[model samples]
Target: MLISLSRVIKGYLLSALLGVVIGSLIGMSRTINELLLPMITVIRQIPMIAWIPLIILWCGIGEESKVVIIVLAAFFPILVNAESGIAQTPESFLEVARLYKLGWWKTFSKVYLPHAIPQILVGLKLGLGVSWMAVVASELIAATSGIGYRMSNARSLMRPDIVIVCMLVIGIVGILMDKAIGIIFELFTPWVEKKRRD
Candidate 1:
């Protein structure tokens, strides 16, 4: 279980970091969005399972492949949400920044980034939910360690009990992770939550 959790965390962090950076770029720049969005859309159309064969071929069903699969699974949700949040920054806010004679960096920091924080948190939650699924799927397909591997091994040995235990554990852990993200959202974007009461 610990092994699986560690691997998932590693992959999730990598995907989140990359997704935020690239998504920010795309959201902030029309040229970058035009260049990347179509290709990204096309790739997103492909199902996760469909990539398994090619991934196995390239990454050879090892730890690398598992992490890659998790990254792929988690990336789009985060990237899309981040882009939406940043790109949808109100023109009024931009105008205010302009009136204040704020530089581009200051404008983004003071205007766009704060507006996007809630959306970014939402994306992170979604990404984390899928990360667990991706790690399990990838591990089931090919892994010598982790809870998924243990479950697969148990199944081969006809141990339904072990399989059930693994599923329950995964569920519990996933819920805990989701709660953690919620706490982060509350801590980081308390104003957004407060606005809900109005």
Candidate 2:
């Protein structure tokens, strides 16, 4: 369980960082969006599992393969949400930034990022869920250790109790991960929370 959790965290962080950067670039650049959007859409349409075999072939059945699978699983939703969020930034906010004669960096930091926080949080939450699911699936098919591997082994040994225990562990861990993200989101976006309460 610990192994799987670590892998999930690592994969989630990597994918989330890359997703945000790439998504922001896509949102900011019409030419890049036009060039890459269709390809991204097509890739996102493919099932996560369908890539398992190819991932295994390329990365082998090691930890790398599993991590890659989790990254792929978590990447698309995050990218989509982040891009959408940035794109949806109010024109009024941009106008205000322009009126202030803010540089591109200042405009993005003070205006775009603040406005996009809520949607980015949503994407992170979704990405976390997908990361957990992907890590478990990858472990089940390829890992020698981890909660999923333990459950797989238990199934082969006819120990339903072990499988059930593993499932519970996974569920509890997932909940904790999500709650952690929520807390971080609130911390970073206190204004949003305040508005909601009002």
Give the TM-score of each candidate: 0.94, 0.97
Off by over 4 Å in 1: none
- What is the per-residue lDDT of model 2 for residues 1-198, given as tens digits with 9 covering 90 to 100? 889988998899999998988888788778999999999999999999999989999999888998999999999989998999889998999999899999989988898888888888889899999998898888888888888899899999999999999988888989988999899888878998998899
TM-score of 1: 0.94
Instruction: Please give the distance, in angstroms, between residue 89's alpha carbon in candidate 2 and its true position after superposition.
Output: 0.7
Q: By summed lDDT, which 10 consecutive residues of candidate 1 come out lowest?
A: 47-56
The C-alpha RMSD of each candidate to the native structure, in angstroms, is 1.4, 1.0
TM-score top scorer:
2
Q: Estimate every model's Cα lDDT from 0 to 1.
A: 0.90, 0.90
lDDT of 2: 0.90
> lDDT by residue for model 1 over 1-198, one digit each (tens)?
998999889989999998887888899889999999999999989988778778989999778888899899999999999999999999999899999999978987889888998888889999998899898988888888999899999999999999999999999999999898888878977888898678
